[model samples]
Target: MPRFMGFVRMVEGGGMPPQALFDAMDKYIGEQAQAGHFLDGGGLFGTEDAVNFVVRKGETTRVDGPYAEAKEVVGGWALLQYDTLEEAIAGQQEFAELHAKYWPECEMVATLRQVSDEAPEAASA
Candidate 1:
């Protein structure tokens, strides 16, 4: 089984989703969880107090957010496991459709990436 991380990115400060969307998601997630597809996931609050640590050259510096340039931020995420790429993609599409059907007005991007336990080839030393 391959594990994937699914991120739901949306515009900043969209306030809250409609209760209908929440209700729909609850039903959807509950079913997936019960079937052992969904591992864990949650929605995030606004990034008013977000912190970032950057290392440039040999120095490290800290930065705080509500970043002016960040138009879209990760609003929600899920940890999922499936049998194949097709299965993962199909699940991702279904999750995205929930947002499309419930919140047609807001723009969102659902990103799905496989989780790698080892470092990439570029990181080999």
Candidate 2:
């Protein structure tokens, strides 16, 4: 089985979604977990709380952000394991559809990427 990460990016300046939407998401997540498609997931704080470090020419510069002109910021993520990429995509599609149906006012984008098999230890060895 391959693992995938579903990145959820919310539109900037969008207000908090309704409680019913959260409830529906909770139920969907629970169902995915029960079906063994979902492994782990979590939401992140706003980008205002984030810090960025840039290393250039052996020097490091630290910067704070509401990161400039960003249209969307990653708001949440989910880890899913599936037999194929199509299955992983299908899972994300379902999530997107749920949002479309329940939280149409909340603009969002969901992207799916397969997890790489390479581990640090394996790469070093």
Candidate 3:
């Protein structure tokens, strides 16, 4: 089985009620966990308040900014382990549907990659 990272994106201020989002997320987590697709996940704040960085010439620089200047930004993400990309995609679609009730334009990103147990830690650039 390969492990994947799932990212959920939403345009800032989509006005999704907090309780509704929470309930949907909870239900989704329960469903995915029961299916052995969920490892862990969490929501995030605005990108303006997110931690980010840039690296150049072997030097690392911390920046207070989002990767892109789009109305939609990554609001949260999860670590998932799935047997195949198809399963991961299915999970992503499910999550998007859960968010669509309040966040009709919410987008989802399912980045599927085989987890490498021996992957080395990246040096601070």
Candidate 4:
């Protein structure tokens, strides 16, 4: 099975979603977990206290947020596993649909990407 990461991106300060959305999401996550599709997942706070380490010219500098230039931030994420890419796509689509159906007033994007299992040495080529 291949693992996929689903990122939920939206503008900061979107505020909490409706309770109905939360209930629907809870049920949806429960179903996915029971199906062995969801491995781990959680929502995240906005980048008010986010930290960034930048390395340049053999020196590292630490930067703190909230970043002024960011238009969208990852509000939530899910680690999932499936037998095929189609299954992953379908799973992501279902998740996105839940948000669309339950929180139609908000705008968001669901990004799905496969996790690479390659060893660091093999990937360095």
Q: State the displacement of the C-alpha of residue 121, model 1, in Å, after optimal TM-score superposition.
A: 6.0
lDDT of 1: 0.91
For candidate 4, list the clashing residue pairs, or say none.
Answer: none
Model 2 stretches with alpha carbons more than 4 Å out: 119-125
Q: List all candidate RMSDs to the true structure.
A: 1.6, 2.8, 3.9, 1.7
Better of 2 and 3 by TM-score: 2
Instruction: After superposing candidate 4 on the true structure, give the runs of residues whose Cα lies further than 4 Å from its correct spot.
Output: 122-125
lDDT of 2 at 93: 96
Q: Quick one: best lDDT, which candidate?
A: 4
Cα lDDT of all candidates, in order?
0.91, 0.89, 0.73, 0.94
User: Residue 120 in model 4: shift from native, Å?
Assistant: 2.7
Ranking by lDDT: 4, 1, 2, 3
Per-residue accuracy of model 2 over 3-41 as CA lDDT, tens digit each = 999999987668887888899999999999999999999
**Candidate 1 stretches greater than 4 Å from native:** 119-125
**For each candidate, how many residue pairs have backbone atoms clashing (under 3 Å)?**
0, 0, 0, 0
Question: Model 2 TM-score?
Answer: 0.88
Local accuracy of candidate 4 as per-residue lDDT tens digits, 30-119:
999999999999999889999989999999999999998999999999999999999999999999999999999889999999999987
